[model samples]
Target: MPSPAPWLYWALLSALFAALTAIFAKVGVKGVDSDLATLIRTVVVLLPLSAFVWLAGKWSNPTALSSKALIFLGLSGLATGASWICYFRALKLGEASKVAPVDKLSLVLIAFFAVVFLGERPAGREWLGIALISVGVIVMATKR
Candidate 1:
């Protein structure tokens, strides 16, 4: 059997990470406040990421980044932090199976933002996937 492409492998790994994140977050947040839970999770992530950053020598590459790129990267980090906080809070309050699908609604948000700000248009299949995701989220959000 042939090896998967690098991007394909990374994508698959990312999906697995996302699945584990929800399960672990749910377990970690059990009987704990979401704010504190997120803080603990941040520490958990930071320790390993800091080690990887040091190992990768990115800590010494400050001169390689343009000022604008650095600013945008910082902003992106802030945005991601905010999103993670909200995601953990939602996971703590809701079922992981439901919250995971709802959180995935971000794909639709990303698609809309891409069209508006990036001038990128989605192909027909992409639109269909977005629509199905939207419908699924709506269905999941509805309580019996």
Candidate 2:
């Protein structure tokens, strides 16, 4: 059989690291303010990401980018900052297992957003999987 796509491998690795991130953040945010913790986490991520881009010789002049690119990236950055702040707060207040599963609801939302905004048509099986994920998140997040 053919091997899975490189993106799948990288995405699985991301999932593993994300799990660790939630666990570590839960412990790290114990006494710290969630917002402050998010700030520190951002610094840690920024330094390494900056170094990686430079070392990979992929760094480019930001000002040379098209206005459209800049605007989308700026908006994406804002959304990421908000998500991290809220995620940290949730981690600080709830169990990682519960919080993280609830957070996967973003996957369902992504499917909807992609269809609406990106005009992507997912196959029936894929839509079924997304529906199951939505149901799972709702089931896990609600009280019995």
Candidate 3:
């Protein structure tokens, strides 16, 4: 049998970790404020990521990056921080099952944004899948 694609493996692992994040955040935010919870989670993420960068010899001087790269990366960092804060707040106020599916609505938005912003066209089948995901998110998010 042929080996599976590398992106598939990493994507699966990321999905698994994301699910765990939702569950853990839901539980962890029980009594703590969501903003504080997000801060703690950011520190926890930084420790391992910092070690990974160091151990893998991936560290580089940020000063060498171009202005566009710096600006986009900085914006991405801000968006990520905002996303985590909102996610933590949602988890604190809602059931994980509900919150997680609603969060995955980003998948649909990602496809749309990729098409518009990146000038990439997804095949019909891919659009079908994205549309289905949008419907699924609506189903999961709404009251019966």
**Model 2 ranges off by over 4 Å:** none
The full ranking of all candidates by TM-score, starting with the best, is 3, 2, 1
Please write out the lDDT profile of model 3 over residues 50-142, one tens digit for every residue: 999999999999999999999999999999999999999999998888889999999998998999999989999999999999999889988
Better of 1 and 2 by lDDT: 2
Q: How many collisions per candidate?
A: 0, 0, 0
Q: Model 2, range 24-114, lDDT digits (tens) per residue?
A: 9999999999999999999999999999999999999999999999999999999999999999999999888788889898999899999
> Lowest summed-lDDT stretch of 10 residues in model 1?
56-65
TM-score of 3: 0.96
Angstrom error of the Cα, residue 54, model 1: value is 1.7
Candidate 2 residue pairs in backbone clash: none
- Candidate 1, residues 11-102: lDDT per residue as tens digits? 98999999999999989889999988888888999999999999988786776889999998999989989989999899888999888988
Which of candidates 1 and 2 is the stronger one according to TM-score?
2
